[model samples]
Target chain A: MCFYIVINDILKGLKNQEHKYIAQAISIVENNSSLNKNLLLNLKTSSMESIKIGITGPPGAGKSSITNQLIKKYRFEDKSVCALLVDPSSPFTKGAVLGDRIRMRDFYNDSKVFIRSIASRGSKGGLAENIDYISDIVEFSGFDVIIYETVGVGQVELDVVDSVDTTIVVLVPESGDDIQVMKAGLIEIADIYVINKYDRKDSDKLFLTLTNMLQLADKDKWIPKIVKTVAINDIGIDSLKDELAIHRKHLIKSNKGLDKYNDRFIKKIKHRLISDFENSFWNKKRYEFLNSEIEKDINDRLDIDSIINKIKSI
Target chain B: MCFYIVINDILKGLKNQEHKYIAQAISIVENNSSLNKNLLLNLKTSSMESIKIGITGPPGAGKSSITNQLIKKYRFEDKSVCALLVDPSSPFTKGAVLGDRIRMRDFYNDSKVFIRSIASRGSKGGLAENIDYISDIVEFSGFDVIIYETVGVGQVELDVVDSVDTTIVVLVPESGDDIQVMKAGLIEIADIYVINKYDRKDSDKLFLTLTNMLQLADKDKWIPKIVKTVAINDIGIDSLKDELAIHRKHLIKSNKGLDKYNDRFIKKIKHRLISDFENSFWNKKRYEFLNSEIEKDINDRLDIDSIINKIKSI
Candidate 1:
C-alpha cells in the first residue's frame, strides 16, 4: 500500500470510530513502522482532548477487574472508553497466556469500548516509544476516556502514571505489609486510591493505614481520596466514578489540568529527542568498534571510568 | 579527609574484609560520591573471582527466606557469602522498614555473612549505579559468593540478572494464576527456579505446569531445574545449592565463564559512557533552555517530531 493511502485510510477510519482502523493503527505504532511516522504527522492536527487515567498497583490487586467495572460504568453513561493494558511481561509468552483479556472479557462485545494489550518488548522505558502516539490517535478517534492499566508497581508503571492526568492506584486488603506499600512508593503517585475487595478481612485496617500514611506525608495540592470497592460484585462503582469526576474537577479548578497535559507533551518531546540522539550517536561501525575494543581490553585491567573516558576522547 | 586518604582507608579496610569498611564503601558507592572513582581505580588490579548469583521474583514470595537458607548452606561449607539486596522500592521508606534485614536476621551475627540493602533512589536504573563497584570491592575482600536479590521481576531486575553468572527466579505456589508467572517472563530468565512455600496445596500443579512449559520452550544450553522449598523450614536448600553449582560448572564447561564476567565489565563501561554522555549533553543551561522551549512550543501546535528534528539540527 502507498504510505499516504494507508495513513489516510487509517485516519479516516479512526475519525469515523471504526474499531478495525484503531486496532491497525495501534499495531503499526506499537511496532514503530514507517507508516506510523506519517500517521503521527497527520495526528498533529487533531485537537481532541481525552481524559487519560492511569490504573496501577501491585500484582494481583484486581486491576483488570476494576478496569472492567470502570469500562461498564463509562459505557452505561453513553461515553466511549478505550483501554490500553500495558503488560510489562515478556513479549514472547504474552500471546499464549493473556490473563488481562480473560479478566476483561465482558468488554469484548461492547462497541463503545475499545481494548488493546501492549507488551513491553523488553524496552528499558517500561513503556513503548509510541504510547503517546497511540493515545493521541485513540483520543482523536473520539474516545471519552483513555485508561492505561499496568500490572505492577514498578518504575515502569510509575512512568506510565506520570504520563496520565489522574492516576488511580488499586490495592487489595492482603496487598502486603505496611512496609511493602511504603516501599513500592505507591503512596507518592496515587491521585485516588482504590481498596478493592473491600469485603475481605482486614480491608478496613488497610484503609485506615493508608489514610493515616497519607496524612503523615507532606500534603499535595489535591489530597488523595481512598475509595473502597468490591469490584467483582459491582459495589461502589458509582462512588469510584464520582471520585474520578471530582478529581478531574479539582485538576481543572486548581488550573493544574493544562499543566499536566503540557508536561506530558514535554516529556514526549524529550524522549523523542533522546532516542534520536542515541540512534545517531551510535552508528553500526562505531558500535562494532566499541564492542571489539571492550572485548580486547577486558583483561587490560583498565577501570570502567577510564575506559569510558577513553571512548569519549576517541 | 583528603580524597586519596579516604580512598586508601576504604581500600585497606575492604582488602582486610573489615565489615565496617565494606559497609562504608557500599554507602559511598551507592551515593555515587566523588571518592568512588579513586576507589574503583585502586581496586581494578585485584583479581578475585566470586560467583555472582541473582535472585529475583515478585513481592511476598519469601525471597529473603530462601536467601537466608542459601546463606546457611554456603556458610556450612565454610565459604563466606556477601549479599546485596537491591530493593527497587523507594529510598524514603527503606530505612523505616528494613524488612529484608528482619527476614534474614540469622545472618546478622554470622561473621561469614555480610548483608546490605540497596534502595533504588529513583535512579533510571532500577539498581544503584555503584552495584558493580560494590560487588567488585566485596569480591576483592575475599567473599566466595556474591548474591544479588531484587524485589520485583521488572526490567531493572532483568538487567541485574543479565550481569550475574547465574540467575534463580523464586516464586510461590499462590503467586497468582498460571498467567502471572508467564506474564512475569520468569520462565525465560531462570537458570534455576525455586518454588518456595512448597507446603501449599497447589504447588505440585504449578510445578507440573512450569515443567510442561519448559518442555514446550526451545531448549537452552542448560535445562532449568525447578527446586521445591519450604524456605522457612529450610527444605530443599541443599538441592538448590547443588543446582547452582552445577550451573556454574556448565558455564565453565561451555567456556563461557570468563566471557560472562567480561560481558558484565563491558556493560558497566557502556552504562558509564552513556551516563556521561547524558550528563554532558544536558547541561544546566541547555536543560533550562530546552524546558523553556518546550513550554513555549507546547501550545504553539508544533509537533514533537519537528521539534526534535530542529533540536538535532541546532
Candidate 2:
C-alpha cells in the first residue's frame, strides 16, 4: 500500500474499531526501525507536518484541562491543530463524565481544531503502537501541532512523553502528595510540570515542595519548572507556553531532546520486532493449541513436561 | 563458560552483589519469544532440580508473608526444598529481610534448604529468563522440589507458573473481599489456593467470601480447591500434600499437564532463537557503525529517518 493510503486505512480502521488492523498498523509503527526501500522513499516524498507534544499525569491531576488549554492556545496561533486523546478502554464502563473530545468541546467546532478520542485497545502505553504514525498523518492533514493527550501516569505514559520533544506533566495542588507517591517514575521523565487548578489555596506550598523535592532527588540536574495554571479559567496558559519555550531551549542547547528521540527511535524498532516475534509465535493457531494444552495439563490432567517435549519435537 | 559453571557463577555473583552475569542472564529471559539450539543445549546440560510453582495475589495483599509460609512448609516437607521467592523486588534499597526465609529457618542443620530471594531485576515480570536458568542449576544440585515462589500476580507470572505442573495462590482472609482484583491474573492460574493465617479472627469470613466469589466467576471450568493453612502452626500441610497428590494423579491420568508443558516448551524454544538472531545482529562491528550514524544524526539534530537509513546501509 502507498504510505499515505496505508496511514489512512489505519485511521479508518481505528475509527471503525477494527481491532486487528489497528494492531497491525501499530506493529508497523513500532517496527519503523526497518529501512524498507518503499518506506524511505515515502519519507522523502511525504510532506508530513508534525508537532508531537506528549502529555501525561497520574489520575485526577487534570491532564485533560491542560490539554484543552494547550489545544486552544495552539488554535490561537493557527487554525490547524489536531488533538488526539488516548483513553483507557479497559476501564471504560467504570465511569466517565467527559470522554476526551466532549471534555474539550469548546474548540471542537472550530475547523482549525481537530479532536479525536482513542481507546487504549490493550496497549499498556497511553498511546498505542501506531499513535505516532497516526499523529504524523494528522499533522500531514495540515494540522499545525499534533497534540498527544494520554490519560494516566504509568511506565508507558512516561515512556511516550520521553519519546517526544515536549513532555508536559500535569499536576494539581494535591499532586504534591502524588508526586511523593510517584517520584521514582515522574521525577526522571518530566521536562515541565504544570500545576493545574493553581487557584487552589495550597498551590504555593505545593510549588515549593516540588522544587525542594527535585533538588534533593535529581542528580542529573533535571529540575523541571513547576508552572502554575488554573486551567479552568485558563489563567496561566501563557506562562505555561513560556515555560515550554524555555524548556525547549534547554533541550536544544543540551541536545538532550535529540538524544532521547534517538533512543526512542531505537527502542520503537526493537519493541515492535520483539512483540511481533511473540505474536507470530503465539498467533491464533498457537493460542488454540496452548488452550488445549492448558486444558489437558492443569485442567484435564496431562504430563506437563512430556507434552512440552511433544511440541519441541515438532 | 560451560552451562553448569555459568549457573554457579550467576548464584555466587548474585550473593556477592556482582550482577554483570545477572544482566546477561536477564537479556536472555527478556527475549521470551525465541530461543536457539546452542543455548537450549547449554541450559539442558546444566539443568538443576528447580520445583516451580505459581504464587499470585492482588496488590499489597501480603504475598511476601505467604511466601514465607510456603518456604517454611518446604523446610518441613523434606528439608531438601530450595525456595526461590521471585518478584516484588523494590529497587530503591537492597532490602535485607529475605522475608520468606526468615519465617522458615528450621533447617539450619539441613544444608539442603537453599533459599534465594529474586526480584524483577528490570521489567515487571518476576521470572522470565534467569529464573529458568537458575532453576536448571538448582535442579542439578539435587534439591527435591525446587520451589519457585512468586509474590503478587500478573500475566507473565501466570505464564511462568503455567510452565509448571502445579500452581498455588496464597491468600488471606481479606482475599474474598479483594477477589475481584485478582480474578484476571490469578483466578485461572492457580491449581490450589492456600489461605494462610487461618488463626486470624476473620478467617471463616474470608473463606466464605472466597467460596461465594469463586462461584460467581467462571474459572475456565477448573474449581481449584481452597485449602486453609494456619502456617504459623504448620496446619493443613498434610492436606495440601494429599491435594497435590490428587492433582498429580489427575495430571498423569489425563495428559492435560503434558499438553500445557508442550505449549511452554515451544515458547521457550522460540524465545531462545529470537534472542540469538537479534544478539548476532547487534553484537557485530556493524552495530557500532549504526550507533555512529545515530549519534551523528541525533547530535547534529538531523532527521530520524536519515539515521535509520544509515544504520540499514551499515
Candidate 3:
C-alpha cells in the first residue's frame, strides 16, 4: 500500500505547472508519497492567493443553497469555482443529503466549475483532516477559489473540514439544539453565523434570541458576525461573500491565520497519530508487552504503571 | 502517572482479597488489575461468587434505569448490590460528564446499595486500566454483587463492559438514532437487549428488526434473548429477572463467563496500551521516522504498508 507513492514521484519527475492540478492532487492522495508529505508541508508555509471559503450548516439549514448561489454568482463573473461537498458518514444518522446535488442539477455539467462530494468514513477528525490537503489540490488545479460545504452538525465534523479563510455557519428559523450553539465552545469557534431562510416571519424571533445570546457572551474583540440570507432566491449572497472577503482580509492583515494554521496542523497530526495507534497497534511489540503484563497478573502481578510507561515511551 | 502508581503501593495494598470471594473479582474491575501481573501469584487460586451484570446501550438508551431497577430488586431481596457506572472521557476533545448520578436520585439514601460512577479521566482504558484496584475500593467495602453500567455504544465500551457474567443492552423505542443499532456493532455483543419503554408503538418494530438482523448473522448458536420492559412502571420486572437468571444458569453450565472474563481482561490491558501510546507517540516517535523518510525524499516512502506496520508494531 505504501509503495504506490511511486506514482507521485513520477508526477514530480515530470513536473509541469500547467498540468491539471486536480490530477496532481489525486495522485498524491491515492499514491502515498514522499512528495505528498512535502506538498503538505509546503501548503503549511504558503500564501492566501486562492481564498478558501467554508459554507456549512446543519440538516435543512440551507448551506448548500447558499453555496449554490455563491457558485452561480462566481460563474456569472466568468470566475472558476470549486465546490467540495461533504456528506454525512452514517447515511442513516442524519439526512443532510437532502437533494444538495439534485438541487444544483443545472450546474452538474458546467465545465468552469469543479464539483466534488466526499463521504466521511467515520474518521475521528471528521472531514476536517482532509480539507487542507484537498483544498491545496483544488486550488492548484486552476480554480480561483474553493467552497467547502459541511454537514450542519457532527461530533468531529464541524471544525475539521476545509478550514476556509472565512467560515460561515448557516442557521434557520426555529433551529433545534439552541443550547448547543450557545455553549461556550461552539459559539467561540464560529466566525460567522448566517441566518438563512430569513424571509420567513419566524426569522425575526430567532434572530432576536441569537442576538441576545451573543450579547450575553463575554467578547474580547472577537464578535462573530450574523448575516441574514434567503438563499433560495439568491438574496444576501453578495453581502455574505463581501463579509467573507473582509474577514479574509482581516486575517491576513493581523497574521492571525499564521498561528492558527500552525496550531491546527500540529493538532491534526497528533489526532491522526492517536487514531492510528488506537485502531491497530498490534503486530509484535504489543504482544510482547501483553505477555509480560499478564505474567504479572492483573490484580497485583502486573506493574501496570511500568507496562503503560513502556508502551507510551515506545 | 506511572510513578504515582508505584509510589502509592496501590497494587499490593488493594490485593488483600484472599478470604473473600467477591473481593477478588471486584478487585479485577475496580483496580482494573492486570491478571497476568503477579499480584495474585502469592494468593491461593480460587473462584469468586458474585453476580456481575453488565448494562449497555446507545447514548440515550435507558441503561441507568435498568440498573436502578436491578439495584432496587436486589435490595428487596436484602442483598448488598454495588453499582459501578463507567463514564467516558478524553480531555483532549470534549470531556464527557458524569450524569447518571443525578438520574439515580433514590439510590443515594440506601445503606445497602453503593453506586459509584467511574470516569475514565483520560485513562488508558476507558475502563479502570488499574482494574482490580478500583473495583477493590468498591468490593472490599463489601457489596455482594456489582452492576456495571456503561454509556453510549461502541466496540470499546461493549468489549470492556461485557467482562461481566451477563450482558444486558437496555434500549428505548422511537429513538432518534435507533438505526445506529443496525449500523453499529451492538447487534452482536449484547447478550440480552431490553426494549425499555415497551408501551411505544415502535417497540415491536425494533424487536423485529433486531431479530431479522441477528438471524442473518453467522453467530446462529448464540441467540441473544430480547426482553421488553417499562422500567418506569416496573412492568415485566419479573420476566426480565427471570431471563437474566436463566441466562446466568446457561452461562455457568456452559462455562462461558470464565472464558469471557479472561479474554476480556487481556484485551482490556492491550487497549489501554494502545490508547496510552497513541496519546503521545506522534510527536514522540513518528516525526523522526516520517521526517527522515521525507528528508531522504524516498518516493515510495512506503506509507500505507508502513502505516499498517507502524500501527500494528507500535
Model 1: DockQ score: 0.36
Better of 2 and 3 by lDDT: 3
Write the candidate numbers in order of decreasing DockQ: 1, 3, 2
Q: Write the per-residue lDDT of candidate 3 for residues A1-314, one digit (tens) a residue.
A: 55446545534432332235454564454343434534442332234656677765544566778988998988888887778776534433242243555666768677777676654433432344455456545654556677877653333333443256677777777452243233212344467879898987778777776777677556564567888999998788888878877787778888766545544444445445554555566557867766665555346544445665576555
| Fraction of native A-B contacts kept, per candidate | 0.23, 0.02, 0.06
Instruction: Calculate DockQ per candidate and list them.
Output: 0.36, 0.07, 0.10
Top TM-score prediction, candidate number: 1
- The regions of model 2 sitting more than 4 angstroms off are A1-218, A223-254, A271-314, B1-51, B87-93, B96-110, B119-127, B147-159, B166-221, B224-250, B283-285, B292-313
For residues B135-178, write the lDDT of model 2, one tens digit per residue. 44454355556566653333335444755667877766644434
RMSD of candidate 2 to the true fold? 9.2
Models ranked on TM-score: 1, 2, 3
TM-scores for the candidates: 0.89, 0.56, 0.56
RMSD of each: 3.3, 9.2, 9.0
Clash number by candidate, in order: 0, 40, 43
Clashing pairs in 1: none
